[model samples]
Target: MTRGYTGEVSPGTPADVRELGTLTISKLSVGPMDNNAYLLRCRATGEQVLIDAANEAPRLLELAGDAGLAAVVTTHRHMDHWVALEEVVATTGARSLVHADDADGLPIPSESLVEGDRVRVGDCELEVIHIVGHTPGSIALVHRDDAGGTHLFTGDSLFPGGVGNTDQDPVRFASLINDVEQKIFDRLPDETWFYPGHGGDSTLGAERPALPDWRARGW
Candidate 1:
């Protein structure tokens, strides 16, 4: 089940919540452009994990509460994804985790994560899968089972109706697309839910059918 909170203006801005089984994903709109940030919580243990601080640390902290944060995970080092990292970390005191390739670009550089690595929060585990199309170090997080379903936290790689832009290096974009097809699409069950960086949530089942068309359009 999913829930949404809109236009509840707070000093730090409030976020929308989507409950999936034992996990609750809080989607926050932060920064000047209202970049999306996520908070994943294990309902059973009350432990939480944040993804991409973006901006509005206070709001995120308020959302995280005293349940305490386990870690702050980033999909890449883009400024939009980490601009408010310092404030969040300072407020929550959570460790920051990112792909090793993009660790140098982090706001508060800390431990690095590699492909196939798993980060655990209470009884929940997120598998890190490198899907580097938007950036050399971009990645996606997959949770095998949560509330009787699978979930994916796709940073900037795969969106609801499209994929990340290929404006950087053509070769890199090609490689990213290939990785998504083989590593992500091929391996995961179609029922998986997708929590993208900047759009409404979708499922692997909802997205797979559109891949061929997206690929044909050279996205």
Candidate 2:
């Protein structure tokens, strides 16, 4: 069966799995907040990594199964994003990782991550990019597939419509959008697919035309 990557996932629905030549990305929605959690498994080595325990540890752990997680990455310090962090880490013994700025907010201690860090999943690796404003230490992970396709895991930093909320603060909003533009939009090709924390996924190309509108609106 050929599965599509529509990026539409509901809390109780099954995960949407996107299988690349060297990696498998399974995305699931969990908790009342509708946080999206991603499980990345390497095809060659069978090693896995879970991004954002989010909520519903039982469901996330069930999805992980016996292979277990090598690490759990928290995108930011938001409570909703890490509601199930402690439990999932306890059960899987996965190393906990979060950006340095948000590290203090997590329930458990984590290895501090920064830009240019590579997170290994068996034979595959994901590069980390630091995005500011949404949170002091918000970070996004970038993965390049075997076929040269780029996949981005943006926590609450970059969404489909615009950047994450900065409470309408102009300074923070500018900081976020600028960083996103320079680091993400300018550097990555339009075909790059981005997976966000809350809602559906979108290609950078789909949103490129809206940057001006988003900046003007001061969101």
User: Which candidate has the highest TM-score of all?
Assistant: 2
Candidate 2, residues 80-151, lDDT tens digits: the string is 999999999999999999999999999999999999999999999999999999999999999998864999
In terms of lDDT, the best-performing candidate is: 2
CA lDDT, candidate 1, residue 219: 70
Please write out the lDDT profile of model 1 over residues 161-211, one tens digit for every residue: 878877856676678778888988899898887877775677778888888
Candidate 1: the clashing residue pairs are 21-147
Candidate 2 residue spans exceeding 4 A from truth: none
Assess every candidate by TM-score.
Answer: 0.90, 0.98
Model 1 scores a TM of: 0.90
